[model samples]
Target: MYLIAGLQPPMDMRLFLHGFQDFFPSKAWQRTPVLYLPLVAFGRMTPMAWEELDQSLYTLHLPTPVTLRHTGFDVTLKRNRIILEATMEASVIDHLSVKIRNLAQRAGVSATRSLLPSGIPLADITDVDPSVCNLWLATHRHRFASTEEVCEFTVFKTGKNRENTFQEVMSDYQFADLFTPPSELL
Candidate 1:
């Protein structure tokens, strides 16, 4: 199943930190809230590349899309929502329902006071049509003269029509980062 979660801004990173644990309770025993890389990979990362990866993982205010791996899920955070692809089985869906509820309840704690439960509630989530992204790419790929132009369009359109402003800063830097080929980042 594909899912989309519409999140609002001024976000507290701890919400996600705790939400990750909530989603995979079994992994809670091993939780360190840290992602480890092999020494060889760590040594090979250029300062800039390391900084880019660090920002993607640690920053809560990022406007560009980024994917972070949790215990059993790969969550892609975009300007408007968090996206995930998972099984549509009844058990998995039930687990999701419980996890989101647990996370929402935790959001009310003083430590996560900046977060709004409504912003992360089930009401804001929807089952996604996976092909929408593919259809979007197919329709728009030919419209731009260059990849950079396509990226610029992507950045500019993010969260612009939403009732709430999520991004405080928009920059040319995001245009390049968002569309850079994955191979180039490694």
Candidate 2:
């Protein structure tokens, strides 16, 4: 968690931050770790942009701000650009990221990285760009212990019961080898 205060920006920007803090107090913001999406956009932003994002997230049935353990978006407006910093769990990040990308696209902002949406075709797992493959592995890392487990899950998502070439897939994509943490850390 990081503070948004410095010399402060123009009056309108200050007002926007003030209003935002009024709703989602600074204490809560500082206590939690913030996860940032790979998207960046330039241009003036308003309270309406935040409201629209809130309304769109509401449609997704996510928990309210009172429960900050799950997910939320914090905007960091610098110069003439704004970055949507997301705080989320691995389980929901993929879904939220796709939605955020769509919203950014509508606003003419391009995402630096693209994530594979759930239910992607099995063939795409091998065909997608390497960066996309890495991002996919990253977003799913928390739920899986090893590449084999991820391969199993991916096959399951594709409506298949098994994958005989787990090694081949894992090697080709370089999801890399899993690391076993020190026992004390665990």
Q: List ranges where model 1 is wrong by over 4 Å.
A: 1-14, 20-28, 35-186
Quote the positional error of residue 84 for candidate 1 in Å: 15
TM-score of each: 0.17, 0.22
User: Which one wins on lDDT?
Assistant: 2
lDDT of each: 0.26, 0.27
What lDDT score goes with residue 141 in model 1?
A: 35
Compare the candidates by TM-score and give the number of the best one.
Answer: 2
Native-referenced Cα lDDT, model 2:
0.27
How well is each residue in 18-48 modelled by candidate 1, as lDDT tens digits? 4443543232123322211100011122335
**Which pairs of residues collide in candidate 1?**
1-86
Instruction: Report the CA-based lDDT of candidate 1 relative to the real structure.
Output: 0.26
lDDT per residue as tens, model 2, 74-185: 3343344322232323444354445444654464433223333222111212223446434534653343111111100100011121121121111011111235346798
Stretches > 4 Å off in candidate 2: 1-44, 61-92, 104-186
